[model samples]
Target chain A: DAGITQSPRHKVTETGTPVTLRCHQTENHRYMYWYRQDPGHGLRLIHYSYGVKDTDKGEVSDGYSVSRSKTEDFLLTLESATSSQTSVYFCAIRTSDRSTDTQYFGPGTRLTVL
Target chain B: SQQGEEDPQALSIQEGENATMNCSYKTSINNLQWYRQNSGRGLVHLILIRSNEREKHSGRLRVTLDTSKKSSSLLITASRAADTASYFCATEPTGPGNTGKLIFGQGTTLQVKP
Candidate 1:
């Protein structure tokens, strides 16, 4: 998947548990994003990071948080998992070229909350 | 709230035929992008068309954007079974402090049968 890797490809967790998903990129792209995909909701952005230590919320940022301490790594944390959060999570890195304005995605992580 | 909405939630066609998908967005955008996702996989960036550009082509794929209509269309010529997948359109809104974030549509599922 475009040099982007998301850890814990599949996970089964219980409600109220804390979970953290990791996204790492080899290209050191400046922009990183976290998204969740559901059956009918399509893909909703959870959060995004433009630079190290710089992050902002997306349309669906509730119940989720993100951190980017370094250039290559972006982390998404679920403070308390809920059944509603069960879905496929994807990470993406925007291409460095401003003209192209394309994004490369990671393989994705499937999480099931029980 | 979703920024983009794709038409024809599901589509099926025979190989060698053509396939088309449409997406409409709510607001002005700097650029629009298309992505493809196979079952149980991450998304792959397909093509991007800037607001100023009306049309773009890549291999067997063609994309056209109409900023006045706030819509875009993707056409695949000579479709193959391997092209069966979900296609999504994402838009990067244009405005101050945009932060290069993308809003994606629910997607159109295409099934090209051989």
Candidate 2:
């Protein structure tokens, strides 16, 4: 729905390895966000971008970085992944209008670090 | 650090019963949103309430936003087994082009037994 897709529906990796997850949207929205969901903590924003070449860190952006080089793609990279980072990663997109628009979510990527 | 937080971290109920969950946020927001995640795979946007509005309804879902108290409540009437999932509340921060960028709260896991 809304043409949002996240790569690697599921992944298993070892600690200290770098991993990059990709989010692609066919809807051509102007805003994109990356978030992680874990037990108890709910969904925490990792990063978000308002437009291409513009990005900002979220509350839990310590070990994460993001890039949006184009309108349709936003990439989230985990530098030196840790076990604590194991969680479901989600991508969201929405139009630029501030007129009560709902954010669309992708099917999420489940990452497990051993 | 999350801007919103859900209470009753977990809730269990029977089919045909009503389910209620609460969410509280720290900062002022333009609007609030509710999402449902089935099996923690993906989050489906359910409903949204703006700061200026007090209550909104969609099908069997009802959402109430108390901007004064900085809290909100979601009620699902006559919930079915399919309603078993984790529910999250998200806030759209007030700013330029802040429509789709949502800050989420920890979720409440709801288990509806059939």
Candidate 3:
């Protein structure tokens, strides 16, 4: 499991509400990623952090934001949730020597917006 | 806006049969990785093949990369029921910068009947 845990394994929220998902890794991996899996779209990257306080947007980062205040915690927040934002979210970690990137994933969080 | 496309949206095979899935990417890649996802869980990294490598094998899994054709394939020999899951392909473009954040492909749902 790589010691990666995602909180709120399942959630149902109304549109226009704010939702936050937390990813915690006990292994202290250098890289953390946020991805959403939708039907027919596979999984799309939303945000990722290379290190603490070093975060970047992914392909689907439009309505999402992420923060990494500590080495073990990466937070993905939806400023205003939408129906389209409902999907299964996954967090992954990578530990490599600056090359040969192989990743480890967490058990996902399934979020539904109505 | 996906970088990769995996063939055969779904597949079904017997436990003793072999399973093969293909992936096609749009851009030159530094490496390609295959991952497996069980029902309602996060993905697990299966194998990785670098651009310089044409083919690699591990246990019952074999991965072949054709950079010129911008495609790759994953083959599992003597498939087991446990191999039933969704498989995804991710690519990292060949470059000097940080393109390590993997861009995933639409997955192939594989069902191995026992």
Candidate 4:
């Protein structure tokens, strides 16, 4: 998984509950991203962080928030879980030394909202 | 909105044959990358082709990009059963404030039967 790990690999939560997913990287890459994969929607970026305390929204940032307080950790929070937000979440880090931007992904976390 | 769209959502081929996948994007991009994901696993970067470069090769994989057409293609020679997986094309959009964010396609599932 390219030295990236996501906690709580599988979780089943009820509606309106708060959920936070953690993504930790050993590579200390500067760029981190959170993405969700669904059946038809493919992979949609939720949010991304360029550096510590610097974050920005992606195409599907609604109902989700992200924080990067440390260089190796990026957190994705769901304020209130909903059925629509149930999907497989993946975290990725971009390679800095490579000539072309290539991303390495972490093992995904599967979340089910009831 | 999705930035990239893949052709042939699902494909079935026999071992020793060749497999090809196509991706088209909506905007100008700095580079195009291909990634493969096995079932219940994280995606692994396959190959990356810059906008200036027309073709790239890595082992048994070949990638070609057409900036004018805003499209790219991935060809796998001598496919094997172990190569059965989902392949996705991601593009890093060109322009100011580019944080190396990637927009991924829906992906094409390849089923290589032995």
- Per-candidate TM-scores read 0.97, 0.92, 0.96, 0.98
Compose the digit string of candidate 2's lDDT tens values, residues B1-114: 688989878999999999999999998898899999888567888988888999999999999999889999999999999899999999988877543567888889899999
How well is each residue in B11-106 modelled by candidate 3, as lDDT tens digits? 999999999999999988888999999998899988889899999998999999999899999999999999999999999877665736888999
Interface RMSD of 4: 0.8
Say which candidate scores most in DockQ.
Answer: 4
lDDT of 4 by residue, A1-114 (tens): 669999989999999999999999998889999999999878899999999999999989999999999999999999999999999999999885656678999999999999
Q: Which ten residues in a row have the lowest lDDT in candidate 1 chain A?
A: A94-103
Pairs with steric clashes in candidate 2: none
Worst 10 residues of 4 chain B by lDDT: B95-104
Q: How many angstroms is residue A7 displaced in model 3 relative to the true structure, after the best TM-score fit?
A: 0.7
Docking class of 4: high
Against the hidden true structure, what lDDT does model 1 obtain? 0.94
Better of 2 and 4 by DockQ: 4
How would the docking of model 1 be graded? high
* Runs with alpha carbons beyond 4 Å of true place in candidate 3: A97-100
Runs with alpha carbons beyond 4 Å of true place in candidate 2: A96-99, B95-99
Q: On a 0 to 1 DockQ scale, where is model 4? A: 0.87
Residue B98 error, candidate 2, Å: 2.5
